[model samples]
Target: MIKSRAVIARGKGEPVEVVRIDLPEPGPGEVLVRVQACGVCHTDLHYREGGINDEFPFLLGHEAAGVVEAVGPGVPDVSENDFVVLNWRAVCGQCRACSRGKPWYCFDTNNADQPMRLEDGTELSPALGIGAFSERTLVHAGQCTRVDPAARPVVVSLLGCGVMAGIGAAINTGGVTRGDSVAVIGCGGVGNGSIAGAALAGAEKVIAVDRDPKKLAWAEEFGATHTVNAAETDAVAAIRSLTGGNGADVVIDAVGRPETFEQAFYARDLAGTAVLVGVPTPEMEIKLPLLDVFGRGGAVKSSWYGDCLPSRDFPMLTNLHQQGRLPLDKFVTEEITLDEVEDAFAKMQRGEVLRSVVVF
Candidate 1:
């Protein structure tokens, strides 16, 4: 066992602390990774607030890029020294989703067989099955998708979650094509990712909607052709106005609120796609007119992790970043240490940063 300092949320609503924990050696089908960088994502904050579960003493942090330090028995896909981005969905080939050839929807994902424990021997529940806020973490071999070593870990790590989700929402879920008009609600990391993805997919116009002017400006950098200050204007009306009074070809709601979702639903042209990429709470519900749903004549989709297959998307995105086609680096608003995660969370909540990466 090795001692690694990691951020731990001991209880519901408790402040996270950096503490030393016992990290065990990799078991079968597992790999030990030395995390180079991890992004402070909202999901980690959700886990801390017990919004995810009652899993206390939670080992937080999941959006990460790292180097494989060790591989356990029967691990064949990756080897030591491989540069990788961690993914929560390590597809099981035998699962129903994988059997149907949609491994991205793999129902039975894999995690490490063993656990990292505290000094008192309490097992830690890793956030998204990848507790990467530490110097090192153990995960299923399949969870570590190899990517270009030339790419910066701090930038590519965002691909492990939010950025990937946003990009996937636009490209995969939305099926955005060349000359399409796309509008993305919420201008945070995921929303900017959708904007970028739409641009990368050759969309003629990408509209960004947000209440924060700073975030809207950032959206421009990510390829938004127009901005809608939702706080000042009717978002649905503004989106329609931007797209020749016909609404966008694809509209994505990155803010999971009912109001924003309603805006997205109404902001798409006839037969156009409306995607929900935001994570909404359990009690939060939407009540749309049944006639509107039938009259819309388009798909209403919920994007799960951007409908991405990490093994396929991670390398492709890394290559795009390396080629300067995808501005992945622009997502890194700041770099911090593990100790500053609490402050980073505050910055994130205040919309001060797109992503505050923790560099080990």
Candidate 2:
């Protein structure tokens, strides 16, 4: 066992506390990772607010990149000192989703069998099965996707969750292609990532929509060709105007609110796809016109983790970052220490930064 400083949310609506915890040795099929950088994501805040579940004394933070410290029994293709990005989707090949060859939708994901506990011996619930807001964390070996060691940990760590979801939402889920006009609603981290992904996919026009001017500017930095202040104008109409009054070929709703969802639904051309990568609260509901849904004649889908296959996408993205094809570095607005996670969460709530990374 080893002692590590970690951020923990003791209960719903409580502030996150940085406390020392005990990490156990990795068991079979597990690997112990010394977290080098972990992104303070909105999901961690959600966990704190009881938006995800009632699980508490929850160890927050998931978006992370780290170095393998040790590999447990039967783990293959990974070793100590390997730089890796942690993923929540560790496919169980025997599951129905994987058995059918769609590992991205793996119903049974793998996680560490052993638990990291609090000093008082309470087993902490790791956020998104990761809980990377620590000096070290134990995870299923498969969760650790090896990437180029040269990749900046602060930048690449965002790919572990939000950035990957945005990219995958465009390329994998929305099927964006060259010459396609894409509009992404909500120019936060995920939305900007979608913008970047659309650019990477060779979209002819990438429109960004958001209430915040700062976020829209950041969106531009991530390759947005146009910006719409949703608070100032009708986003759907603006998107249509930008796309010759026919709307975009693809519209991504990165803000999972009902109003933004409606905007995304209407901001696509007749045959264009609308991808919902935003996570909606359980009680929030969408009421769409049934006739419109039928008449729109396009796909309406939700993207889970951008429908990504981590092992395949992570390395590819890392390579793209290395080759300068993908500008992943622009996502990290700030780098902070683990103890500053609570402050980072405040910054996130205030929309002060795209991503505040906890760097070890």
Q: Candidate 1, residues 240-312: lDDT per residue as tens digits? A: 9888899999999999999999999999999989999999999999999999999989899999999999999
The global Cα lDDT (0 to 1) of model 1 is 0.96
Q: How much is 249 displaced in model 1, in angstroms?
A: 0.9
User: Cα RMSDs of all predictions?
Assistant: 0.6, 0.8
lDDT of 2 by residue, 7-27 (tens): 999998888899999988888
**Over 4 Å off, model 2:** none
The true-versus-predicted C-alpha distance at residue 332 of model 1, in Å, is: 0.5
Q: After superposition, how far is residue 50 of candidate 2 from its true place, in Å?
A: 0.8
Clashes of each: 0, 0
lDDT of 1 at 14: 85
